[model samples]
Target chain A: MFITSAYAAADTAAKLGEEAVKKKNVFPPFDPSTFTSQLLWLAITFGIFYFLMARVVLPRIGNILEVRRDRISQDLEEAQRLKEETDASIAAYEQELAEARKNAHTIAREASETAKLAADKERQKTEAKLANTLAQAEQTVRKVKDAALAQIDTIASDTTQAIISRLIGTKVTKAELAKAISKIAK
Target chain B: MATHPDPIKQFAINKLLPLDINGVDLSFTNSSLFMVATVVLTSAYFLWSTGGRGMVPTRSQSVSEIVYEFVAGMLRDSAGSSGMKFFPFVFSLFMFILIINMFGMFPYFLTVTAHIIITIALAMAVFLTVLVVGFGRHGVGFLKLFVPSGVPMLIMPLVIAIEIISFIARPISHSVRLFANMLAGHITLKVFAGFIVSLSAMGTVGIVGSILPFAMTVGMTALEFLVAFLQAYVFTMLTCMYINDALHPGGH
Candidate 1:
C-alpha cells in the first residue's frame, strides 16, 4: 500500500518538474524574467533596513552603551570620593584624639606638681612653728633653773649659821659671832 | 525514473504581488517576500529588544549587542579605526544575510541567498562602495592596490596583471561563494531526502535501508545550518578585508 502511494507521489513530482521545465526552460534562479523583481525588492528592503540601522537602531544601541559606560565611571568616581572623605575624617579624628590625650597628660602632671609644691610649703611652715615653740620652752626652763639654784645657795647659808649658833655653849656678842662664822665659813 | 522528486522545483519563484513601474517586471516573487521578512524580523527584533535601553541588558538585548559588537569588532580589526565609517553598511549587510540565511533553514521557506542575482547585487554594492571610497580618499593612487611593492622589476608587469585580474574577480568570487554554498547545500539536502522517500517505497528491507538516508538527511540539515551562518560570516569578513584594502590602498 505504501509502495504504491510513494510511486504515485514520485510520478506526480516528475510531471510537475516536466511542467516547470516546459513553462520556463531556464532554471528558476537563472531565469531572467524574475531578475528585475528580485533586484527591485532587494533594493527596497535592504535600503529600508540600512536606513533604519544607520539612523535609528545603531545610534540607539550606541547611546545605550555610552550611557552605561558613563554611569559606571561616575559611580566609581563617587565611591572613590566618598572613600577619600572617610579617610580624611578618620585622620582628623585620630589627630584630635591624640591632642586631647596630650592635654589630659599635661593637666594631670601640672595638678600633681602644684599639689606637691603646696604640700612642701605647708610642711616647712609647720616645722618652723614647732621650732619656735621649742626655743621658748627652753628659755623658760633656764630661768626656772637659775631661781632654784639661788634659793639653794641661800638655804645652805642659813643652815650653816644655825648650826654654828647651836654649837656654841653661850650666846656671844653679834659682832664677835659674825666674825667667827665668817672665818669658819671661809 | 519518473517516480523521483525534482529537487530544482523548490527554487521556483512564485509571484506574490504582481507589480510594474514604467513597464518593468518588478513582480514581488518568493525571493522578494523572504527579503522583506528578513528586514522586518531584523528591524523589529533590534528595535523591540533595545527599547528598554537598560544599563543591564535583557536576554534579547544581549543578543542584539553581541551582534552589533561582533560586526563592529570585525570591521575595526580589518580596517582599523579609519574604516569605522563603513560600520552601518557592514552591519546591515551582515544582519541581512545572517537573518535571511536563517530564514531559509525553515522548511518551505525560500532561501534568497541561493540566487546568484541577489548575492551579485550585494557583492556589487560592496565593490562599488570600495571603488568610490578608495578613489575618493586617495584619488588615482587607489590604483596602487594593484601594484604590489618589492616585486622583481622583471616580473612586475606580470604581478600587476595578476593583481588587477584578481581584484576584478573579487566580486564574482565573493557573490558566487555564498550563492553556490546555499544553492548546493539545499539541493543536496533535498536530493538526500528524496533518496529516503524513494528507498522507503520498497518492501521491509527498503524501509530499513531508508533509515540510513534519513540519518544522513538529519546530519546534512545540521551542517546546512552551520553553513548558513558561516557563509554570512565569510561574506562579511571579505567585505571588511576589501574595505580595508580600499582604505589603505598602500597595503598594511
Candidate 2:
C-alpha cells in the first residue's frame, strides 16, 4: 500500500530498512511469518472454549435431561403403586363392610329368636296361673252353696218346734231334732 | 516510495499492558484494541438488538436472524443433521470473521482478518477441531477418511498418503482463500482511491476522466463488499464440510 510521508528529512531518507525503523524507535511492521501472540491466543481461546463446552455446559444439560427423565419415570411408577394401594384399600373396606352387615344381621336374628322364646315362656306361665285361679273360684262357689242350705234348714226346724210347743206344750229330745233337721236339709 | 506504512504506523497505539504479573509481554497494542473493539461492537450490537426480544424482530435482530438462518441453512445443506450440534461454533466464527472483514473496509480500522496469522490461526483451530472430532467419533474408522474405497491394493498406500497431505493442506487453502481475496481487494481499492485523489487534484479533464476509475471503484467496491461476505461464508462452509466428513466418514 502507498503511503505519503511528510516527516522524512534528507539525512533520514538516506538510511533504509532496519536502521531507519530503529531510528524511528518503531517496531518494524510485524511480518506475518513471525506473528506469534495472535496464534497462541487463538489456540488458547479455542481450547478453553472447547473444554468448557464439552466438559461443563453440555454435560450439565445432558444430566438435567437424564434426571428429568428419571424423575418422570419414578413419578409414574409411584402413581401406579399408589393407585394399587388405593384399590386394595377400597376392596378391603368393601369386604369389611359386607362382613359387618352379615354379623349385624345374624345378631338381629338371634335377638329376635331369644325374644320369641321368652314371650312363649311368659304365655305358658300366665296360662297356668289362670287355671289355678279358676279352681280356687269354683271351690269358693261350692262352699257358699253348702253354707246357705244349712242356714235354710236350721231356720225351718226352729219355726216347726215353736209351733209344736204352742199346740202340745212338750220339750223335744236332741236325737229327734237332729233327725228332723237332717230330713229337712235333704 | 515510502518504505513503511505511514498512516498505519501513525494509527498504531500501544498505551497499556494487561500482563504485569508474569511480565509475559501481554501488552495491549493497536491490534489488541481493534480486536477488543470488534468483540465489543459485535456483542453490544447483538445484545442490544435481541435484548428487547420482540417476536417481530427489530432491524438489528432481523439482520441477526437472517445471518443465523443463512448459516444454519448452509450447515444443514452441507453437513446434514449432525451439524446441528456444532451450530454455536460455526455461527460464532462466521460472525467474528464477517465483522472483521467488514471492519477492514472501514477507512481507519485495522482488520484482524487481513492478517495471515489471524486467518491461518483461525483456520488451524478449525482444522485441529475437525481432526479431534473425527478421531474422537470414529476411532480407527476415521483413518478411512484418508483411504478411499475400491482403490487398487498396490496403490492404496500412495492414495492414503496423498489423502493425508490434502487433508493437512485444508487449513492452509482455507486461510489463503480469504487472506488473498481481502488483500487483493483492499490493495486495488487503495490504488483506485489514489487515482480519485489525483484526478480531483487535476482541474477539468482530470475531473471527467476520474469518473471512469471512480465508477469502476464504486462497482468494484460493491463487488468487494460481496467478496468480503462471501469469503467469510466460504471459510465457514468449508469448515462445516470438513466436520461433516469427520462425522460421517466414507464419503456420504
Candidate 3:
C-alpha cells in the first residue's frame, strides 16, 4: 500500500518538478537462492534426524531388540529342555504301558487256556459217568425180565394139566404129560 | 505429451472443505481419503475373498491363503513358532498399507501410509508394545537390555545413556523414513508439473519441459510403487521383530 501511494505521489511530484526523476526498486522480489535454502534445510533435517535415530534412538531400540531376541532364544531353549523332560517321562510311561499290556495279554491267554482245560476235564468226567449208569440200568432190567418169564412158564403148565384131568374125568401120569407138553410147545 | 498438461497434478485430488479451526485449517485431504479407502478396501477384500470358502480354495480364496501364508512365514521368520500369536496384527498392518498404496494408483484414494503422522503412529504403537511386553515379561531385567554383557566399567554409563536415547528414537526414524520418501516424491512431482505447464504455455519452443518430468515421473512412479510395497513390509517386519521380543525375552 505504501509503495503504491508513494509511486502515485512521485508521479504528481514529477509533474510539479518538470525535471525527470529516477525510479528505483529498493528490494528485489524473487530469489532462486531459496532452492538452495530448501536443500540446506532438507539436508540438516535429515542429518539431525539421522543422528537422533542412528546414533541415539536406533541403538536403544537395538538394545531392546537384542534383549527381545535373546529372551526368545532363551525361552526356546527352556521350552526344549522342558520338552525333553516331558519326552523322557512319556517314554518311561510308554515303556510301562507296554509292559503292562504284555502282562495283561499273557494273563488273558493263561486264563483262557485254564478254562478250556477245565471244560475238557469236566466233559470227560461226565461222559464216563453216563456210560457207567447205562451199564448198571441194563443189568437190573435183564434180571427182572428173566424172573417174570420163569413164573409165566410155570403157570401155563399147571393150567394145561388141570384142564386135561377134567376132560378125561380121571388122573394121568405126570412124566407122560410133561413129555407131551414139551413136544407140543416146541 | 498427449495426456493432460500435468499428470502429477492429477495425483493430488483437491476436495476443498469449508471448515477451519484454531487457524489450523483441517480438510479431508487425499491422504486422509486414501487412508479411509485403504481400511475399507482391505476389509472388503478380505470379506469378499473368504466369503465363500470351501475345502478347496477358489481364486480369491487362494489369494487370501497366499497372503495369510506369506505373513505367517514372515512372522515365523521374525518371531518363531509362537509368533503365530501376532499373525492377525501383523497381517492386518501389511494388508492395510499394501492396499492403500495399490489403491492409490487410482485417480482417487490417497496413500495414507505416505503421511508421517500415520506411519509414526504405527511405529510408535509397535515401539510401545515392545516396551510394554518386554518389561511385562522380564520386569527390571528388560532395562539390562541396554547394558550389554561384558562391558568395561569406564564406558558403561555412556553406552547405557546412548542406548536409551537410541531406543526412544526408533519409532521416529522408522516412521519418517516412509513419510519423507512419499512426501518428497509427491512434492517433486508437483514441481515438475508446474514446469510442464510453463513450458507448454511458452508456445512450441517451450515443449522441452515435457521430456524430463515425463522420464522422472515414470521412474519415480515405478520407484514409488516399489516403495509402497517395501514400506508396508518393513513396517510389518519390524512389528514382527518387536513381537518376537515379547515372546522370547532371552531367546529360550
Candidate 4:
C-alpha cells in the first residue's frame, strides 16, 4: 500500500510538471509575461512609499530631534547663567564682610586713643591741685612757728625779771634787766 | 496518496485581481498583495511610533528612530552630507525592501524581492536616478566617472572602457544579487524541508533520519532571516555609494 501511494505521488508530480511546462516553457522568473505586472506594482507601491516618506514621515521625526537638541542646549545655557550669578553674589557678600570688619577695627582704635587722652588730662589736673595744697600747708606751718618764737621771747623776759626780784628781794628796773638779758641773749 | 510537494510551486505567482491596462497583464498577483502589505505595515509602524513625538522616545518610538538614524548614518558615511537630499528615496528603498524581505520569511509568503522583475525595477530606478542627478549636476563632466585620473596615457582608453562596461553592468549585478540571494535561500530551505517530508513518509527509520534535514531546515530558515536583513543593507549601502559617485564623479 505504501509503495503504491508513493508511485501515485510521483506520477502526480510528473503530471504537474508537465502541466507547468505546457502552460509556460520558461521558468516563472524568466518568464517575460509577468514582468509588466511586477513592474507596475513595484512602481505604484514604491511611489506611494516615497511620497509618504518625503512628505509626511521623515520631516516630522527630524523636527522632533531638532527640537529636543534645542531644548537641551537652552537648558545648559540657563544653568551656566545661573552659576555665574551665584558666584557674583557670593563675591559681593564676602567683600562687604571684609569692609565691615575693617571699619569695626578702625572705630575700636579711635575709641581707645580718646579714652587714653582723657585719662592723661585727668591725672595732670589732679597732680597740679595737690602741689598747690602742699605749698599752702608749708606757709601756714612757718607762720605758726614765728608766732611761737615771739611768745617765747616775751615769756623769757618776764621770767627773768620775776626771778631776779624773788631772789634778791629787790625791785629790778626794766631797762637794767633788759640790759642784762640782752647781754645774756647776745 | 500523499500529494507531491513541489518546491518551485512556492514561487509561482497567483492572480488575486486580474488587471489589464490596454494589452498589458498588470494583474494584482500575490506579489502585489505582499508589496501592498509591506507598504502598509511600514507606514503604520512609522506613523504610530512617531505619533507622540516625545522628547524622550517611547520604546516603539525608539525603534523607529533607530532605524531612521541607522539608514541616515549609513548614507551620510558613504555619500557625504550633501547627498542627504536623496535621504527619502534611499530611506524608502531600504525600508520597503527590508520589510518586504522580512515578509518573505514566513512559511507561505511571497517574496517580492525574489522576483527578478521587481529587483531589476528597483535597481533601474536607482540607475536612472544616478544618471539624471549626475548629468543634471555635472552635465557632460559626468562622463569623467568613466575616466580615472592618473591612469597612464597608454592604458587610459582601456581603463575608461572597463569603467564604462562596469558602470553599465551595475544595475544587472545589483538587481541579480538581491533576487538570486532570496531565490536561492528560499529554494534551499524548501528543498531541505522536502527531504524531511519525503523521509518521514518512509517509516520508523525514515522518521528518525528526517531529524537531520529538519535541523538543517531550521538552520537554513535562520540563515534566510539574516540574509533578508543583510541583503537589504547591502542593497542600500551600494545605492548610497552609487549616489556618491554621481554627486562626485571625480571619485575623490
How does each model score on lDDT?
0.92, 0.72, 0.64, 0.92
Which 10-residue window in model 3 chain B sums to the lowest lDDT? B6-15
lDDT of 3 by residue, A1-186 (tens): 999999999998887565222111111111121223223322343334334333433343334445656878999999999999999999999999999999999999999999999999999999899989988888888888888887765666677778878997766566766777778889
- DockQ (C-alpha based) per candidate is 0.61, 0.05, 0.01, 0.56
Candidate 1 lDDT by residue in tens digits, B1-252: 568988887888999889888968899888988999999999999999999999999999999999989999999999999998999999999999999999999989889999999999999999999999999999999999988888889999999999999999999999999999999999999999999989888978889999998999999999999999999999999999999999999884
Q: After superposition, how far is residue B145 of candidate 2 from its true place, in Å?
A: 0.5
Model 2 chain A scores worst on lDDT over the 10 consecutive residues at A26-35
RMSD in Å for all candidates: 8.6, 14.2, 16.4, 8.0
Model 4 per-residue lDDT tens digits across residues B171-190 = 99999999999999998999
Q: Give lDDT tens digits, candidate 2, residues B137-218.
A: 9998898898898999999999989999998889999998987787767777767766876786687988998998899888
- Model 2: DockQ vs. true structure: 0.05
**Where does model 4 exceed 4 Å of error?**
A1-25, A101-186, B1-4
Better of 2 and 4 by TM-score: 4
Local error of candidate 4 at B102, Å?
Answer: 0.5
User: For candidate 1, lDDT tens digit of each residue in A53-93?
Assistant: 99999999989988998999999999999999999999999
Chain B TM-score of candidate number 1: 0.98
Superposed by TM-score, candidate 1 places the C-alpha of residue B72 at a distance from the truth, in angstroms, of 2.2
